[model samples]
Target: MKHRHILLVGASFSGAVIGRELAEAGHRVTVAEARSHVAGNCHTERDPETGVMVHIYGPHIFHTDDVEVWAYVNRFAQFRPYTNRVKITARGQVFSLPVNLHTINQFFGSTMRPDAARAFIAERSDTSITDPQTFEEQALRFIGRELYETFFKGYTAKQWGRHPHDLPASILKRLPVRFSYDDNYFSHEFQGMPAHGYTALVQTMLDHPNIEVVLNTTIDQAAASGYDHVFYSGPIDAWFGHALGRLAYRTLDFHRFSCEGDYQGCAVMNYADKDIPWTRITEHKHLSPWESHEGSVLYREHPRECGPGDIPYYPIRLVTEKQMLAEYVERAQAVRGITFVGRLGTYRYLDMDVTVREALDTARHYLACLERGTAMPAFTTSPL
Candidate 1:
């Protein structure tokens, strides 16, 4: 059996998972990370002043129904139960998120039951617009103008920096308007936060004898060719020096503040009004409800377009961006001795579980391809 030398860019969940798998399979894996920390966007560290676990980027609750992924993460660190109950301030009043039965009743000031609330919203909704195309249209068709303006309109504009009419309808589809009073943000069967921290978990994942992790090191195209095969998890456009121009991304700017005692009395409080410059305020201490803290640390999240040196949070896949991505994908496929994996590599927005699942699949596919004496394609999953 010939041992292969593989180069993996980025030390996040995707890179670490794939590197560990390949290293365990008798391959020498080298993980190159530009950031000093291991976890990328999911990085969490203890606040030096407040002694609270803070999500450096933003709150990332681990919620997924994938049984294998859940078990895999638990092997590294103990997961404490967590339910993301979000609250929103709209029209000078606080309401439960997802526009539940209680929220509908509170907004309308009626004691209507679930069925009656449903009927009331139906009456309020614009039934004339049968087929919704844009985000604004979808909101108006389902929840009516009042709810849309109060909750969705201002927030959507601030978050995306574009009018809801210009965005795709699918962006709003993930948000559910529930008839029940359930306040859990996600509908997944398993939901929790790692007891230690995401960075610690990632460090554990990269703790193999055959794996070498280089921090604060960015590998260029010249270094990529030295390895037997390369697994690039960095930005797809960066790999090619942005030959087709940079793909648009939305980056987040978080404002941190600390106060003694409880802050907002909740984990997350979203300001639905557009007047507010920042989108939401999250109390870090409340994120770990099991632990007690004398002081609280909070962050005001503001979303804007990505600029140079800014960490891209979300990919803005508009019509033009999709065409640009297609062109890059075509060029990427022609390259040999390299494979693109993970979210940035494939140029798609993916959750932690999906990233891990895809990394496992990519490693498995690579091994199977080698066993069959066949060459692996640049992307295991098609970006287009």
Candidate 2:
């Protein structure tokens, strides 16, 4: 196959993985990042004062079931085994996350076995709702009113910037209620964190001779003709300059502070009360157990609506927003010489592993399209 110029927007996992693979395949790749650094939201940096690796945006734990993706990331940076065991503060006590058997037994002040605990929770759960319609209904049906109010209600409201009743039932399905003692936040077979940070990992990926990285450089549709094909990982609505309307998204605000010792015993401690304001408090030192730091950097995370010039975090695909997303999808489908990729481009909240997996698939699909002499799709992956 002949080499062609490729323009990739955003220097996150989506862009890094795709650009690296394509560059290795002899395609001249140009990566333009709006930020001054690579690794978009997963960007990690050492706190200048404390020497602790702080997740500049937030905590990103690399966990996936895909063996290939795990191996792919490991090739770039040394990955240290890390399991996220989150703790939550709710109703005046700390409890294990994912609501395990221990949590249920402790929460109710009763020593019950797994079978008894399962039966007890089932009795408490609202069985009348066969099919849950909203987030509130789903939680209530799964764990009953008390547990829902204690564990999920306020946190869910804060995280999405909407009342639980307004959010879809599917949003609550990612969390699992376990009858076992396993407290691992994610059930993926592989999980770990890079020894050196995500930025260093991405820098290594984009170190190919065929690739050119231009940080703090913004690329738009007008520059599409400069490259043979553009791999755009930017916001789909923003690509069109929000012509239809700005799709709703939730952004995060962090209140960063430093302390002499461990701020929180655990890496993450979520505040499950609306009155608390901030959703969670994260201690950067705990995230990397391999490194020891006398001083710790912490971030009190507050979630809110993504306003103008805010870094959009979670895409709120409410009913109306989904309709708007469909319009944006249609507009993108009509365009040529550009392929939309990644979370913002596809308008979905994707994990790091899934993003890398999709990037690999997108690059492979593009290569296949080239070999067949077929036109590359504007969206290799659909937003809706």
Candidate 3:
């Protein structure tokens, strides 16, 4: 077996997974992360004040229908059974998220079955707009004005700092209003949180004999050239020095506070009013129900435009950003011995399962390309 030196930038799931795979395949992999910690945005640490495992960035639930990914994560850490039942406060009323049967009944003050609820929403839906262009239009065509305005309008405005109509319709497609009583936030078959925390899980993955992790450092093209191949997971635009202009991204600022007992009864409580400064409050203790803690830690999330130093959460991917991403893709493709991978690298919003799945796929693809004596493309998965 031939061993090649590989440079992997960003020690998050993207870099860790690929580094582990390459290392196991007899390659010497070096992982460099700009952050002091390893897990990137998925980093988690124990709250000293409350003794609760806190998701430093935000809550990340491992939920996936992909059996291989589920099993792969389980190998690293014990995953406890957890279901995200989200609650939203809107117009002085609390309701279950996804606008389930109970939410519909409670919001309208009527006792209705699943079928009746379906018919009621259908009657209220704005049929005049056949082809919904924007998020606001999509909401009007499906859930009607009342549900949209009450639950989505104000929330969307605060979340994106823009009107729902100004944003793409794809944003609203992520949320689904269920007609059934199922309040589970995700519909995946396997859903759980790592018992120890995501950082521990990621650390376990990077614990390979053939791998060396270098933290508090960023890798540039010149520095990466010494390696046989480089797997970059940083922002795509940043890799090229943002020559085509910076891609749009949304970053979150959390106001962390400690409470005596239960702050919010649930793990997540969304404020669906524009007047509210923060978007949602997450109780760290609730996320780890398997452990008992005397105090609770809470984070009030506020979304804003990503700046130079802020951690980019999700790509905006509006028309202008897409165009700029296209330019970056062109420049990246011209480069050799480099492969951009993961959410930041591809400038796409990816879930944890999808990130792992893609990492597995990318490793396999890279191995195949090596065996065939072929050059690996800049991106294993298309960003656009």
Candidate 4:
């Protein structure tokens, strides 16, 4: 295979993983990260004030059932065992997340078994609404209005910056209601956090001699023209400069504050009440349970509309955004010598493990295309 110099627009997992795979294949990889750091949103740094490893973007727990992805990440960084047991403060009461049996029993002040609780929830659910359209309707159909309002209602509205009625029903499918007392936020068989934080893991991936990481550089499509192939991980709409229309996204504002000793006692504590300004307070120290820290650092996460100069967190793919995305994707297809990858590139929210999986698959797909003597398509994975 002829060695080709490939330009990756972002140095996050999407770019770093792809770079590593390609570099090992005798290809020169250039990873251009707009931010000063290599890890995009999964960036973690040691807090100078408290000596705690703070997730600069937010808390990211690696959890996935994909054995390949789990083993692949472990090769870069040693991972410590972790289970994300989320706690939610709803109506001044602390309850385990995923609306488990313990939470249901505690909420109603009744001792109910798994079968009884399941039946109870069924009775409470609105069977009248045969077809649930919006998020509110979906929650009511499955978990009933009481549980929906108590937990999902306020949090969903705050996270998306839109009313539940306007949101899609698919949004509510992520959260599961378990009859068992299992409070584990995710059911993935493989789950852990990188021992030295995500940044270290990414830095290790880009350590190959064939790979060069360019920090604080915004490499647009025009700038990437010199490369044989450009794996653009930046926003798909951004590549074309939003010629059709700007896709909607939700950005987060983190208010950092420190306190002596353990603050929340847990890694993540979500404020389920709408009255609370912030969505969740993440205690960084708790994230690294093995490490000892006298002082605790936390981030009060606030989600709002993504403006021109904001770091886009979640893509709000509403009806209008989807329509706009179709136009941008069409433009992306017509382009040559470029392939869009990653969450922002695809215009969707993705977990860290999924990002890694897709990155690995994309690299393999590109290699297969090259061997077959075929033109590499604009996108290895479908954005839609």
Global lDDT scores for all candidate models: 0.91, 0.93, 0.93, 0.93
- Each candidate's clash count: 0, 0, 0, 0
The CA lDDT at 237 in model 4 is 86
| Clash pairs for candidate 3 | none
Once fitted onto the true fold, the runs of candidate 3 whose alpha carbons sit more than 4 angstroms away are none
TM-score of each: 0.98, 0.99, 0.99, 0.99
lDDT of 1 by residue, 147-215 (tens): 899999999999999999999888888899988889898999999999888989999999999999999
Regions of model 1 farther than 4 Å from truth:
none
| Clashes (candidate 3) | 0
Report residue 210 deviation for candidate 4 (angstroms): 0.3
Better candidate by lDDT, 1 or 3 = 3
